[model samples]
Target: MVSSISLSIDSDLDKVSLLARAVRALCEDLLGPDDQDAVELSLVEAINNVIKHGYHGERGKDVQVAVGLQADQVVIEVIDHAPPMPAQVLDKAPEDTFAFDEADLADIPEGGMGLALIRMNMDEVEYHSGDSENRLRMVKRIAPRSQ
Candidate 1:
């Protein structure tokens, strides 16, 4: 069985909290505690990317967020019309995320960690865009429910 929820919000950062809360309330019963947090954070990163990289933090763009549960996997999709991700970001493989040695950790900057963090939390992440809509999706698999 599959259950899902869909909502659209402006690109304003302020509405991100409302979006996250709606997604969480819809997903809470389908995901375990850890998985719920993973989905929430991953979705936030994806949406923020669309706002930051795509729309350049503009507030007028419409962002569509859809979250669903399919068997043991949770699915999240973020759609926007801002712009496709930059070529540099598209070229990075998940394994290419910044690696910090104990000493290098102190120099790690903020902001750029969004994509890496989303990849860390979700089992699968994908992006697609054309002239109008850019789509980002993340999936996380959950342990089987104890019967």
Candidate 2:
């Protein structure tokens, strides 16, 4: 199956849920239940990040989120007007797993985990920011059907 959808809205946090619904609808026949949840999780994280970090909670900044379904995978794209993130941060992948060490638990940071969640949930995550717009793309591979 193949399909695509896109949404452009202001950076208001209230509208984030709308983006999630659009993504879910796009993946209706493309992703299985588990994969659907992962896509929602990752997409939400990206939308929230754009609202928080990209627009700094301005609420009026423009942002766009899109989803495309392929025969074997789903692709997600997010575009925003905020400045680009550092190359190092964008290039780095999230840790394979997240487990807190009891001894250092108190030192754990408060908010830097969105990217990790996005990377962990999606099969592939990429970003590019330049020429006045920043783009984030994530891909989730569909599981094979049982024989």
Candidate 3:
């Protein structure tokens, strides 16, 4: 089975929650509640990164989020027109899961965990930069709903 929905929003942080809610709703019947939360969180983090880093928090910029259910997977693509991320950032995969050194509170960096969070939640994460735009694609496997 296959189904998809796309939503467009200005690069404003406030709008992200609304879009996330819509996405969570879309996944409700197809995915379990916990998976639904993962989808929402991943999408939120991806969109937030685009708005803050890609658009430099500038409002009115174009951002599109598309969620699709194909077979036993959920595919999400976050598209934007801002500059693409640096190659180093895009190439680095989560080799070792994120661990916190609770030993020292000051040791942890402030922010910069969006990509990690997205990667941890989604099964597959990829980014493509085109001449006119950049796209970040994320996919998560889901159990097929019983007929």
Question: Best candidate, lDDT-wise?
Answer: 3
- For candidate 1, the TM-score is 0.87
When 1 and 2 are scored with lDDT, the better candidate is 2
| lDDT-sorted candidate list, best first | 3, 2, 1
Q: Write the per-residue lDDT of candidate 3 for residues 81-146, one digit (tens) a residue.
A: 998898877665554334557578886656557888888888889899989799899998987667
lDDT at residue 60 of model 1 (Cα atoms): 90
Q: What TM value does model 2 have?
A: 0.89
User: CA lDDT of each candidate?
Assistant: 0.82, 0.83, 0.86
TM-scores for every predicted model: 0.87, 0.89, 0.90
Clashes of each: 0, 0, 0
| Cα shift from native, residue 15, model 2 (Å) | 1.0
Which residue pairs show backbone clashes in model 3?
none
After TM-score superposition, what is the CA distance of residue 12 in candidate 3 from its true location, in Å?
0.7
For 62-93, candidate 1 gives per-residue lDDT tens digits of 99988777887888889888756787876666
The CA root-mean-square deviation of candidate 1, after full C-alpha superposition on the true structure, stands at: 2.1
- Residue 11 error for model 2, in Å? 0.4
lDDT of 2 by residue, 1-147 (tens): 677777898888898888787788778777888889999999889989988877789988888887787888899999998978767666554662345564797766566578889988999988887798988999999898888
